[model samples]
Target: MEFADRVILVTGASSGLGRHAARALALAGATVVLLGRHEKRLDGVYDDILAAGGAQPVIMPFDLAEADDPRFNALAATLAHQLGRLDGILHSAAQFIKLSKLEHQRLKHWEAAFATNLMAPFALTRACLPLLEGAEDAAVLFSAEEHGLNPGPYWGGFGLSQAALIALAELFAAEHQDNPNLRFNVLIPGPVSSPMRHRTHPGEVPENLPKPESLLPFYLTWLGPQSRGRSGEVIRPDLGYDPSRQD
Candidate 1:
């Protein structure tokens, strides 16, 4: 129970990387606060955690793209009131609107992409700064993607927003470099057999890609005590991280 007594928030807990990360964090003994727009899906995750003997999870149904400052502040206030402290945050929520050319990308698509991928994280993190800083050791994990690191054709706003998300993580780490309690880093879970991958690459065989569960170790290491003092990094497990070895 590396994360025993810790409280962690996971956005996009309805599906994909976020859902898997939420369950993994809870299993490792963290009280997982599942945040997403889909109430039913969040309930499923909450039940899964209980059935697996993990900590009881909280379901917070929220639309990331549409959330405003008041909503973000209220979320922080609620966490502070209920959880007392926040130990970690996994910004796994994302918005993707298919593969399209830069010119073909609609204004609304860009707005939604940046809102969920970049703005929401910024607002939430800002609101929860005091709670995170209050913890003995707090970590924030921002999810990035291959297209964000290396922008190519047809990636559009989704790629750009994620690229900004990477920068946001770096900035957070740099700003708090002197603070011993806080750490921020980005994780790039590449080509996993996830819903997003299927939507982006319809022709690809799902069996060929690693299952979402395979990336749990990476999430655990980053969000848990194993990653102490590790900040401002863009970690790519698919690139060369050896999960078999200890961090």
Candidate 2:
């Protein structure tokens, strides 16, 4: 689907799925706002999008883990001053330091994981609500994981944060159910051959997993107008699920 005139923000835009999604969204005619901590990587993605003839993207360099509510609010204000309105926000940023049993996990590790995977998305979305509401259609998508839904041994704080994201998505959807302009949903990009997956499942063969770009169709369907009126749902592209099918 085309996103002509739409302005979308993507966290973790420096690399992996976030990078791929940003490029694809830009190519689809959306003006992208690239958010990430790494200024160098963000610039690379920005340049790639420009070279590909995509809309000139805005690079927002902010560390999600260290940002507070005021910082997020300020970001929203900046976006409003620049783009006027926000059509979508894709929460693709995540942190997984390591896999450890609950008893073995350090307090700092748990805090860091929660801050990036849960708190940042929640805070950013809350701050951007006003901008999102200004659009005719807006979407907030949270990146989920298989371990989050089906918790298993040694998943640790990373898994817990992901599980919380599902709840966060559902809560946002419920809160905005009456507001036809906004929607929220969770997406699980299962077994993608990305750095996170490589780190989490080092034993798995990289070639066996789907490429990050493979999720573009699903991403477009959910973030664009195609999935309008569809919210509070958990989408699993790896399951061959068709989001267009309401049934």
Candidate 3:
């Protein structure tokens, strides 16, 4: 129960990297709040946590692309009013649809991707800033693509969104460094065998890829109090430790 008594909110809690992180934190006894667009899927994940005997998580169904700034503020304010403060938040939600060439990419997809992946994180983080600062040790982690990987013509919207999120992470880290209890970091979950991965690389054999659950150790470390001093770090379970045998 590493996170016992603390509150943690995770976006994209329905699947992939977000699911792993949320599950890991919940299992460690955090009162996880799952935020996603699909209530049914979110409920399924919430049930998984309950079945695992993890702290029961609350689900907040929201479509970040369509939600206004007040929606995010209301969520945070509600948490503050009810829970007193937010101990952690993970911006793991993303839209990884078509990887069209820049010229071929639909403007709608690009805009929605940016809205959900970049703008939403900024809005939600800003809304929760005060509450986060109130925590004895607070963390705000965002997801990023692997560094040094040049996205090709087929990686348009998703690639651009990833770049934007990385930039946002850097900006937040730079601005918040002097704050004692706030830590912000970007994480890269590379090639995990997930629905998004299957959508991206349909021809690849799924058996050769690592499972999403393999990232638990990194998830636990980054989400818990152990990562209090780790800010602005670009974390990668694939690089820092072997997911197959975490130590």
Candidate 4:
């Protein structure tokens, strides 16, 4: 699963699954563009990649929640001027403020969640499509959540955003199904011991759960050449599920 000359963008690259994915992708020979709001944390990941002999990564500190279409377009322009083309994008940034009932949820929190988890990906992908289309084979991966798939009480904004992301991925895939160069897929990294998971399930023993690194193989499979023809599939690695099975 080598990405010798590939250029990939990973949001939320300062920590958790995004950080781990950036490191692994760098190790796999891809020039990873790390995007996050925290400059200090982004530098930490960048230095770690350098220390590990991985390709020197680029850091783009930006807040997804506040990013408007113009900002997204500017980012796309910058990437185009610098990298010329993009091989893939892993939409790993997310916002999970708390678990609350819809009635009690603050409108600001709801808007923020959708902005980061859904709208940002949609706009970012839309902006990057031209760059992706220029690549020989390109992929866009949307992070999914189990609660989004099977919603229950108290899931509220975060859950709704994720569910919308699933639909968004499907819609993008269907729209581009005839385009041999581009593909989109959703990945649900279930029960990973991420900061988001820790906040969501505080009582769970962290040691019992898989770390973010546990999803690397699946990441490579989806983002690299191996997943070229696949599109619009929900990939749930934790369940050992096959994409062929609709249910």
**Total clashes for model 2:** 0
**How far is each candidate from the true structure, as Cα RMSD in Å?**
4.2, 4.7, 3.5, 4.4
* lDDT (Cα, tens digit) per residue for candidate 1, span 1-247: 9999999999998899899899888888999999999899999999988898888988899998998999999999999999899999999888887898888889999999999999999999999999999999999999988888887889988889988888898899999999977999999988787888889878777666778988999999999899998889988876333334322
Each model's number of backbone clashes? 0, 0, 1, 0
Off by over 4 Å in 3: 147-149, 239-247
lDDT of 3 by residue, 1-247 (tens): 8899999999999988898889889989999999999999999999999998899898889898887888989999889887787998988888775766677878888888889888999999999999998899998988777621355567887787888788888899899999868999887878787888888777677666788778778777777788888788888676333335422
Question: How big is the positional error of residue 199 in model 4, measured in Å on the Cα after superposition?
Answer: 0.2
| lDDT per residue as tens, model 4, 175-226 | 9999978899999998887888889988777766777777999999899999
Worst 10 residues of 4 by lDDT: 238-247
Q: lDDT per model, in order?
A: 0.90, 0.91, 0.84, 0.91
Q: Which stretches of candidate 4 lie over 4 Å from their true place?
A: 239-247
Question: What lDDT is reached at residue 16 by model 2?
Answer: 93
Query: What would the TM-scores of all predictions be?
Result: 0.95, 0.95, 0.93, 0.95
Span of 10 residues, lowest total lDDT, candidate 2: 238-247
Model 2 misplacement above 4 A: 239-247
- CA error at residue 193 for candidate 4, angstroms: 0.5
